[model samples]
Target: MYAQPQPQTTGRYIDLFPYIPWLLTGGMVFALIFGALWERTMVSTNLLVNPDTAAELKPIQLKKEPIGALRIDVNASISYNQWVTYEIQVKDQQGKVLASGIKQAWAESGTWVEEGESGTWAENDLMGGLDVRANQSEPVIIAIDVLEYSDTAGKEIDKPVSFQVIVKNGVVDDRYLWTGLFGTLLLSVLALFTVSSTGKVVINKSNPDSDVVARAICGNKDRLIRVVVKVQSDEYSPSSLHIRLTVNDANGEQLYSQTHLVNVKRSKSDGKVTSGSSALTTFFVLEPRGSYGFHAEVTPDASVDRTRIIVRENARTLFPVKVVTLKSSDAQ
Candidate 1:
């Protein structure tokens, strides 16, 4: 018999259906991440007041200067408990009402209603933002002016708002705060370095005498403040180092300078290289409304043990000497 025909072998191919679920899950994860980043959140970014209210309350009206009408744009929405009569009042310096009435304020739906997100305010779209500058340029008799607020029943809010306005006399921009923070960091780092390497340094208020002195004065038309520092060394000793201080107001166009010379003379002791003393005094000239801080740098003659002291009127903080030595190999 011819070779018996072997039974035809049959094989089944398994479908890749199981992997579809895994591929789908991976795609979903990536999609979610992309969607989160792509989503846009539009709101009144320069929100001066914290609208993240804790409870049944509106944003806190922070104390700030009224830049006439030029500084602000207003959008408002209101709901009223009931139709109630409200009054407007602007006060004088003597706390007397200069004007009071229901002054007509042009109101409309803000153009920024893009899905409850605060849209950008355009110059032309400045709604109902009555130019308070015309009446606001000079000190007013009206105790208050409703520049703009969320309304209650188509009427101005009569609710007693706990708000006050405080104006900054000079420019205190982001740079100022950043630099201040940086300076503070530098001081802290230096302080730590000194402690780790040498020992403790202290800051103390200086007693004014022949060796130590302090003086301060305001400068410029805008009352820009500057400092002048002077230190005169006497007795022709090696420890005597004269210090000159100069301060200039960086607040405005006009720069003013004030200076004071203080003497840093040798003490009445052995004129040893390491046996000497130093003192520092600071002067501050503050306007009726202004904020300021001191910036100080010190230079010593040769390699004397100089004191890094921060002195105020009644308090002083001292930083230690940080000697950074270099090894010959490291230098190479």
Candidate 2:
């Protein structure tokens, strides 16, 4: 008579496949943070412009490798409800226009009353940014031209509008990084369902009789096996169900046995009570590469009109489960 070996209960076993997506997520986060820090280390300059006057900033030298970027930010001092627009251009040392754009700044405030609530709210927005990539290391000049100054009523203002411009180099573009992070997160969610399945169903029977019996052959030794029993009952069935699972070796000798309790709950849909089903699972390890017999029995057989039994081999879960050792007397 050959005795079966006990299941391994020592060190932990971690499956790294499920965690690969999280690892990729971490990498994208690191990249976004690193890009922000690198942007702060670049050179920045500020210039002032008055009405009807153009401001030309000093020549700026850019890095050749990795290519450099230029960012222009404009700020204006105006009266309430006033708006100002500026034309911005990036030119080479020879005065050739490399890039050009327009930006606007405005400020406004008003009162609102809705649903017996009255409050004063002030809102302002600025659409004043120009970003361009610098392909050459040669010095370039930034030029700013005041295009228009007016009030919210479309009336031209005679007063001069002072403007401040900020120019920065080596600014990293975060659009691609954000896109990559989003794509990686989506794929990670999808991988959880596709890559984490390690179990294969050996037997699946519906509406099985009490004391259901099945045989399964395992090609691998010391692999985990899972038994699942599901019961579907109407609202009139009992609240709880008891189940018994037994495993035996080729010689008809019992190896393990355990009892499970499944609770049944009733659900309401479209103003009608519906049947509810619950499942109970038991796990064990088969040590020898051979065929084994499984037996399952459910109590209150009349209450459980619908029953399903499943036997799975090489079963693995996303999380670890505790496997308890059973003595010879535990079998019934």
Candidate 3:
């Protein structure tokens, strides 16, 4: 009788699908690093401001980019529990206001006791930024006008404050980068579960005999096979069970053999003791495209009241396996 050919398998491609998201994540990391390095500081200076005076800085020459724009950042230093509101403006050499906005900064501190635990707390936030896309290369001026200065209790304060101003070229909008990275990471996590392929069950028998045997065919030489054995008993059973698993080629030549000691745990339901069960699992790859035999046996068979043997072909695990070959073994 002529033997039928096995079906073509796409197991290799399926196994590689899970890594695509990780590759995207790596690319995102590279882009983020490159963007941070590409940015250059165009201006860094400090301005002193009185309660009712506007600080005007020297003219700054800015070059317009063909693709992206520049960024302006301002930070204020104020006393505790005090707040300052200021107006920022970017003007052309002719004193025309091209862009303008109002911003505020404040700092506060206090102590609190909650749930019998006491601690001191302090919070201070002081920074603002703006994006500018120059239509053409020109000289411009940056002006800061302090509008109001007061304490948190609505008391006016008369004082001089220092402000740090910064202008940067090639500024990258990290909002999109961060959003893309977050989405890619989520996809990578989901791929671990959705992209993995499941195997076909070759044998699923309950209450199997002490020495059970089954035969299965290997469609792909690169795919893995899994063997799972479950033993069930009662409270009187022993604490552990010893199991032996063996795989043989079509010619009755042993290819793999291993022994495992599985610890039995009594299952509980509604705070009551139930049946006890223990399981043993092993994985191996069959390189030859042909039929193979699986054998399983349990020691001290009297300790197990029921048994189950599950053999699966083309098994895909959550993580990649590193296969190592030895002169006398073919399992890992």
> Candidate 3: lDDT of 114?
98
lDDT of 3 by residue, 212-291 (tens): 67777663456566678888876556677788877677777776666778888887779655667888766665665567
Q: How far off is residue 319 in model 3, in Å?
A: 7.8
Going through the candidates in order, what is the number of backbone clashes in each? Answer: 24, 0, 0
Pick the winner on lDDT between candidates 1 and 3.
3
lDDT of 2 by residue, 243-307 (tens): 88777766677876667787877676895657766678766666556677777777877656677
Q: What TM-score against the true fold does each predicted structure earn? A: 0.20, 0.71, 0.66
Best by lDDT: 3
Better candidate number, 1 or 3, judged by TM-score: 3
Model 1, position 5, has a per-residue lDDT of 18
Give the true-structure RMSD of model 2: 5.5
How does each model score on lDDT?
0.31, 0.69, 0.74
Top TM-score: which candidate number?
2
Q: By lDDT, rank the candidates, best first.
A: 3, 2, 1
What pairs collide in candidate 3? none
